[model samples]
Target: MRYEAHLRARALERPQHAALVCAGQRISYAALADIAERFASALVAGAGFGNGERCVLFLDNRAETAAGLFGTLRAGGMFSVINPTTKADKLAYVLNNCEASVLVTQASLLPVARAAAAQAPSVRHVVVVDAAGELAGHEVPWDEFIAAPSILDPASRGIDIDLAMLVYTSGSTGEPKGVMMTHKNIEHAATSITTYLRMSPDDVVLSVLPLAFDYGLYQLLMCVKLGATLVLEKSFAFPQKILPLLESERITGFPLVPTMAALIVQLRNFRPEWAASVKFLTNTAAALPPAHIARLRELFPQARVYSMYGMTESKRCTWLPPEELDRRPDSVGIAIPFTEAWVAGEDGKPLPPGAVGELVVRGGHVMQGYWRNPEATDKALKPGRYPWEKVLHTGDLFRMDADGFLYFVGRKDDIIKSRGEKVSPKEVENVLYALPGVREAAVVGVPDPVLGRALKAILAVEDGASIAPRDVIAHCAARLEDFMVPRLIEFRDALPKTNTGKIRRAALQAEAEGRELPGEDA
Candidate 1:
């Protein structure tokens, strides 16, 4: 079923139930549904948005953003959420690539939105939210658009197989590519995930991850799907502010990424009461270091910590069950409920347990393909066991244990060969995290005539914690094999991160290559 239908159903069955709490606004199921329908009227009447057209939402975590999501589908059109921090050039590239019919954004972001929409000829309307009375001639105030009489005639709505949303993720080529997910694909994935999480209407979920990130967006969608209350926030940059919401909202489910968790673990004077109401904690975007996960358990003693692995191509691939967390902290766990995944060798056959190979996933959650890019799609979606099926070939390398638990090695291209021996950066980085002073770490291969490519350790140490190159090298040498240890090490105040807070490894690799290698030998 379409995501919009879930909101409508909740509105009809439990109109008075609280559906959303954001920015001092407590919106009920009935109110949220009305907002969605009215926004649909705005899209259809104001922009002439037609069936299957694209609407790009350049917004933050707000009530209108949620309304816009469901409204686009209600109008039988697909929607895309662009990261609010995206610059004009990149945003324009996405707008043109998707040929977006409407651009929905907030007043503060109007500068970049206005510039990008000006370049995208396909954008017919620029709908501005959170604006004052005055508006640019080309801009349509959100209040005016949604407040107008309901001019939308619900003659048609999207079916199960129609595209529901386009999630634009960073492409391997540095440009962005939109991952198209259908209503059926999303429904199945959402159902399977919520079943595994055991979420219900009584649950109150809180999230600060961006709407542009699929994981964050699902928190909003899944909560609505189950008739639950969602307490949405814009950022976790200041945990002091975010921490209070857990207790204030009586949050049951808390979803976070590794970076957020890192900050939480380091925060001083964390009150036991802050986590008293949290029933579970879900983590992805990257596996939490086993050491960090242990600390998180200490912090949220009552909360079940779930470590998961996924990509934009497929919503989620595997989740380490809370029951099995201590036993298998290193593994990303089995494939998420109902999905079948295996490690495939170069010959396109399943590899035996304990052998590393590319990960292959077969499920409804696998994205149909990249939008308008068949070349990349062909490389990712290949023949499945069934002739009619196209399974997603996740380019990441992994190994499954005898019990069918998967261990992420690294991305196919992320593996570094040094001293004529292959090295997984994740493995080295995991050990680095165990160090007392280290907060964040990324390992990359640097040019070396002797070792072929030397493993270099780049780290972000904790504040006021003194860490030296020798200290890092010595720690790794104690735990890692000779070739697996780094040959050089560097320290930075903070490692570069994506908008989602993932360490920008590719950016580091490129920067490392341009500069001359350091050391007397060089």
Candidate 2:
């Protein structure tokens, strides 16, 4: 089935049904489908978009963002949603990497969008939402862009194996790598995840996660697939504002990460009665501590809390059934439906139960690979047990109980998962190194209850440099995304090094994880 199938079916079957509710406006399925179809027409007639072409959506979580997304798919083109917080350089890099033909953005972000699009020769059109009448030769207003006459041919719809999305993720080497996924892959992941979550058309789910994130994107896709209602919020930063929606919207499904759960734990005025309608509460990114889990149960007494684990590569890996949570709150549960996951040692052999090893997942939900990066693709998608198959080797360490329940140990790589968003230390360090420090720079993830893994930057600057923490923060703020900026900064006279003169990153990581570094009191 196509990704936009639900929008079409819902528009026909439940025309008046509310599909999305965001920012005080409610959009019906029929309205959404019409918008998507109009957008499809616009893509073809206005931008000369073809069946394998790419469209980059750089906007916030709103009805328009949702429409632009399915519209690209409806038009048989691939789409990528960049985080609204992404800087111009990264945005431009993604545009160039995907060779996007169209970019859907807002007038407020035109400065950055224009800057990025100026550098991207592949971009043919910049569709601006809420723009004034004046426009550039290559620019078009949202209203006029969607007004194109329909010229779609149903027979031309592509097959499921065609590329459907390009989700750019943080690379280990200070760059962004696009994760490639086809329609078939997305369908499998959405189906497998929804099957275990017990989602249904009757459910009204509330999502505060960014659409740029796969976790949040699926919430929209699955809701539309089931004809369910999605109440979108910009963020969970203000729990007080979002808490009331649980009752008003009759929200049954609540998806969160460790950071949101931590925020929940900090709410003193939280009333369990406020969430009486909530049926399913899910968490991922980082497993919640047992005490936090216990507290969550008391907070959402009627809701079944599911602690899940996954990444963009697989979309989702494991989901702990709510019934089994009390028994093993620390475990991220078993492999999702229609999938196989096992732990393997360094030698690529299966590890005995209870032995920590890299998690290996074999499933149709596995991403196609990184876009334009075959070397990285080979590293992640290694040969499976069968001759013709390849499996995803999640760079994470986990141990399984004899019963097959998996418990997370730690990451095999240094990609810091902060606030449910992956932050490459190298990427952050690259920005730090360019801050005129005149010396050394390093970044590490420090264990934190709230942020999942708070980013900390350690530096040894020149003797005469007068840079302070605020100055460094300002410099990073001007360059990197907000999530990539280091929250904690410390200066040292010297940095630890190996006998070979290479900086020891692990030493700093261990210190941030609570152990003392060399020359410190043990």
Candidate 3:
């Protein structure tokens, strides 16, 4: 079940089916499979990058990015996909930390790629897509890469648990950390999702998520395994242009986050018929507030809406069923196929249902470890679980109900303390978002004289909508209790977000404390 195995299977089973669509270009399964193989050959023989080397892919959501990923795997080398928005300093840290030997990037990103490479002496070559330029010491034109004649080495028969990819995460502490994933780990995740989602060759998926994220990477693997059609959209900025394509192409499956979900429901003149062509609407990355969930149901009443939960440490842990929307609307649902999870107490002992504790998962989808950080690896993984012995201890806290449904609380670090009462920041943020005229809101704990930490709120209002800071605080007073309501409010045009699209509360707290000034946009 390696990546190429899925590619080969799809090529034989559904060669004529569209394997990738972007802009106006469409590629069949056979064509994609063939290009990946050629790209792999070029890496090994033409460029002398073989087994054990790591190649960093710095590109956006494009067909060539997918090609570079599978091609690296096919060449018996581990790969890491970088975020397109990563700047010089952070990008240099990841390259140097992983000791990447090669970099594969699109033409537009080559300048940044070369700058990052300059800081890491381990990098031997640069592979550029559609651009030719000498990068001081190393450069190769990616335009002629696949067309070049290069010998393909024998496929790796190594243990399936061998390293295949180094997926870097936004390090909350400082620098980003790379999470090592095996071929088996990737395959198991893809298989588990495809089975439960009931994906088939008939499913046509239009993906807007980036390939660097685990959630987005799984879409590619699932499509290959199920022999389904995949349309790789760059972004979800223009719903007007994208919605028609969804109907015209009859796209049946889509994975979106709450941000995109909010925008989709806001589309003018949106009809059920436009989205009726899609059979499944999946969500992840962050928890969808109950209010947003209700709105999604109203928009796509006929489509099955799946609320899933997972992290980079493990691909996906659980999924709430569309049928259980009414009964357990708040729960994240049972463990995904071949995965096992449980709540653990403060002492690290397992807890039974209804106990609020850390959620730990054990499965094939669990990553091997952080690329080179043994300390962080030891903290995250443990022994004695299912699928694999290595267990992934997710830092977020959750509680399970009698029927095995998981309800997410705030992150362990995100909890606020007021008069000895532990309050969830997410709870306050959710209420703030529900207020009229508010477009986005973030809650955080700030220094206080009487209490150890006081509740603080940051709000972003929609254009032309008016609301005073006191009015916003008063709105929270009506919904939340005296201690739970935020004592201070700050208004801004936008909230700071992580690369993966979660609100950056730490940054807001820093801004509140005057330790740092807000960004120009703010």
Candidate 4:
């Protein structure tokens, strides 16, 4: 079923319930539904947006972002959300690549939006939110854009198989690829995830991750499907201020990545009682260090912690149940509910337990394909055992335990080759995380004449902690094999990360190779 139908159903059943809360502004189910319907009508009547057209949203985490998303879906158009921090050139690339017909953004970002829209000829209209003065000929203030009479006619123009969203990847290796997801694909994923999390109408979710990241986007989508309240925040920049807001909102569910966890664990004055209302904690993007997992449990003794693994190709692949955290803290756990995950050898045959291979997933949640990139799409989606099926071949390497729990080994390309032996960066990083005063750690291979590729460990230490390079190397030498141990150690104030909080290893590798860093401009 279409996602907007969930909002409509919730509005009919619980009109007065809070659907979204951001910056002290609360929108009720009925109000949000009405605003979305009005916006959809405006897109169709005023802007002449045709069925299956593309509407791109370039806004921060706010109530209007939600409205723009649902409205585009209701109007029978696909929607794509660009990171607000994106520059003009990359933004223009996305607009032209998708051939977007409309662009919605706030006045605060008008300069960049205007510049990008100028280069994208396909963008026929620009809807400006929070405008100050008269708009340009192609621009319309949000109020004027959504002033059309509410109409429900456009919602019936599409079927479940139609495209719903075009989520762009972070593009660490090359140009970003748009992942195409259909309504049925999204619905299945949302249903499976919420079912595993045991979500209900009374649950209040606090989201700090960017909406452009599918991990963060799903939090909003799942809450809407369950008729739960969502509290949106721009970022976790100031955790001290967010603590009180969490308490005041009585947030029950908190979603985070490893970067946020590292920041929280380092807060000197943090206390467990401050966030006692948190009923559950969920983490992905990267595996939370076992130390951080233990610390999080100490801080929120009442909350259950779920360690998950996924990529943009499939919304989610696996999640470790809270009850199993003690037994398999390192494993990403079995396949998420309603999905099947297996480790496949290079020949595409399933590997036995304890063997390392590529992770393959079979489920309806897998994306249709990458937009306008058939070569990459074919590489990712391959023939399954059945003649009619296609399964997603995740490039990540993993090993399955005897009981079927999966442990992540690094990415296939990310594996370090040193001293004629293959080494998993995650293995070395995991050891580094166990060291005292190490806040974050990343391992990459640098060119070496003798060893072929020398292992380098880049780290960020906790504030006021004394950790020298020799100390880190000595610690690794004690726990790791000689070949697996890092040959070089460098400390930085912070590791560069994607908007979703995953470390940009490719960026670090580029710096090591003395090359221009990718994504620095965009």
Candidate 5:
């Protein structure tokens, strides 16, 4: 069954149950179901999109955004959620690449959406959810469309293989490619996570991540599937306001990135009561520093802190359980049910325990392929026969322990090379973060004339802490060899981050030219 069916089942089971809570708004399961059905009907009756069609959802974290996502699923169409902060060029790329027929966005975004849609002729309809307005040459005022009666169209039936959401990811080059996730893929991801986490029906999840990111999107779906409550937020920039919400709403599940976790653990007067009722605290998007892990464990002693590893290619591969967290603090944990992780060396041979190699995943949760990009898809879905099943080649590096626990090293592309020697940026970043007064650190390889490539570290200092580049370099020198030490270091107010809260190494590399990187011990 599709995610929408799960919502309907929940509505039927408990009509009055709170399904979605965004800011001050509360939507019951029944009300949310009806709105989704009505919105789906509007697309079928008003818009000219049908089964297997795609719609672009370009709104922030609001009630309408959630409705539009589920509505597309129910209408037998794929929903592509565009990042609200997506610039015009990227937006144009996704709309044209996906051949989106309809775009559901807030009124404030109509002007930008219309501008981007102008470049993509396939987009025929633009529906605005907020302040009503008319675009020069498009259908606007989304409310007018949804007011139409719900249609019981036979085509609305969604099966397991039907596409539910088409999430696009940035390619190695320009123009992001779409990742098609069917209902079964999404359901399996949600069910497996909910089952592993042991989420209860009374759990309330505080969603501070963007729905455009699949990891964040699944939090909402899992909540609906398990009859839990979702408290949505656009961002976590304001921890002061968010801390109270977690307490007031009695949030049981909270997921965050390493950057956000660092901030929350260091907040002034941060108390256990801030997350007193929270049962689970999840970390993804980026690996958490071992120091930060200890701090979080101290703060949320009652909560089960989970460290999960995944990418857009496969919804999820492995999740480190809270039980093993203290013992194997560095491990990414065991693979989820129905999933297998085999670390292969450069020669494509499976590596034994304690040997690091490329991490590959085989499971139903893997994406079908990159949308309309056969070459890229073929590269990622490297054909591997495993008992009548295919596996996905995740470009991540990992290692397995003696007990079959997996530990993440770094991305294949993220590894820095200097003088024909490879260095893991995560290791350098972790060493920097271990130093007192260091808040966050990102390591990148920069061009060098002598060594061929040089290492650089960007440091973000903790509030009110005095730490210089020399101090950081000295700390790394004590822990690492001369080659592993960053040759150059620069202090930043904040590091550049992706929408999912991961440090963007590509962006950091682009900005590292001519600035005299910190470490050069040659």
Candidate 6:
């Protein structure tokens, strides 16, 4: 089924049910549906947007963000949501790349959005939400654009196979690539994930992750499919303030990344009961250390912690069941429901257990390909078992245990070779996380005349804790082999992270090699 149909069904069934809660504002299902339909009519009838046209949303986590998403789908158009913090240049790149016809943003972000929109000549309309005054001839205020009353449901002109969303990845190596997903792909992913998570209409989810990230976007999709209430937050920058919303809203599910997990465990005055209402916690973007998992369980005694692994190419790959957390805390679990996952060697053949190789996935939810980039698409999608099918070749490295549990080794490009020996950064970072006072850690390979490449350990210490470079070296020396130990150690107030919260290893390597880094706001 198409995603917009889910909202329509929910609106008819439970018109007064709370569909979205953001910054003390509650929007009912009927209200959200009405607004989305109105905006969809405006896009087609007023703004002259054709079917399958692209609309880029550059707004924060507000109620209007949800409206814009469903409205685009309802209008039979594809949508791409950009990170609100993105600068003009990168924003222009995405706008031009997708050749978006409409740009939807808030009045507060007009300075950057307007600048980027000027460079993207294909943008025919700029709809400013919460605008204070009359807009330019080409731009229209959101309320004024959707003011006309029209049919709630337009004639169906597109099918499930049509493109639905474009999720742009953070470009650490070069320009960002937009991952293409269809309505069927989204439906399958949401169905499989919600099935495993056991979501229902009574579920209340709390999401602080950005909508630009696929992992964060699915939170809204899954909750809407189940007719659940979603509580949106701008960010986890201030955890103390978010803790209260978790309690008052009685949030049943909370999604997090490793960075947020580290911050939560380090909070000095944290109270266990602050998260007592949370029934389950889900994690992705990066694996959580076993220690953090233990600490989370201690804090939310009644909640179940699910450790998951996924990327932008596919919505998700694997998820470790909460019951097996103690047995294989390091593993990212098995393939998600209805999905097939396996490790393949360089020959493209499946590898035996305990052998490290690239992870391959086959499922309905795998992305179609990168938008307008066939070279990158060919590299990522390869021939499947059948002649008509292509499977996703995830660049992530993994190894399966005897019981078929998958452990993330590192990315294919993230491996470090020193003294003619290959080293997995994840392996070393896991040991660093075990050390006292080490809040966050990353391992990168630095060029060396003698060793070819030497390992470097970069870390961030816990709040109010002190650990010298020698102490970190000494700690690694005891836990790692001679070649695996870092030749250099550096401490930073914070590690460079992608917009989605993954460590920017390439940026760190560029800094070590004295190279200018690309714009990371994308």
Tell me, by lDDT, which candidate is best.
2
Tens-place lDDT per residue, model 3, 1-522, is 456677877888888889998768898988887888888888887778867788899988888888788888888888898867666555778889988888888778777777788898888888888785554547777767778653675555255777989987644343456888898988888888888888888999988877877777778888887888888887778887777777888989988876577787666688667677788888875556667778777877667889888777788899988899778877888889998888888666778888899898878899988988998788888766344477788887999998889987645555554433345677677778889899988887776433436778888899999998888888877655455678878888898887777778877766655677355322
lDDT by residue (12-102, candidate 1, tens digit) is 9999998999999999999999989999988887778889999999999999999999999999999999878777877899999999999
lDDT of 4 at 374: 91
Q: TM-scores, in order shown?
A: 0.81, 0.97, 0.79, 0.81, 0.80, 0.81
What is candidate 6's local distance difference test score? 0.85
Error of 4 at 47 (Å): 1.1
Model 2: lDDT to the true structure:
0.89
TM-score of 2: 0.97
Candidate 3 vs. true structure, TM-score: 0.79
Per-residue lDDT of 468 in model 5: 78
Prediction-by-prediction clash tally: 0, 0, 0, 0, 7, 0
lDDT of 5 by residue, 303-373 (tens): 89998888877888899988898798877888887777789886556899999899888888988888889
lDDT of 2 by residue, 1-522 (tens): 777776888999999999999989999999998999889988987788889899999999989999999999988999999988888999999999999999999988888999999999999999999997677889989988998656776543688889899999998887899999998999999999989988889999999999999999999999998899999999987889898899889899999888788788888888766789998899888888888888888888888888899999999999888889879978899999999999999866789999999999999999999999999999999989889999999999999999999988878787989888889998998888898854888899988876778888899999899899999898999998888988888999988887777778878888788776554322
Stretches > 4 Å off in candidate 1: 151-156, 414-522
If both were scored by TM-score, which would come out higher, candidate 4 or candidate 5? 4
At residue 304, what lDDT does model 4 achieve?
Answer: 89
> What is every candidate's alpha-carbon RMSD to the true fold?
10.6, 2.4, 10.7, 11.0, 10.6, 10.9
lDDT of each: 0.85, 0.89, 0.78, 0.86, 0.80, 0.85
Worst 10 residues of 6 by lDDT: 414-423
Q: List the residue pairs that clash in candidate 2.
A: none
Better of 3 and 6 by lDDT: 6
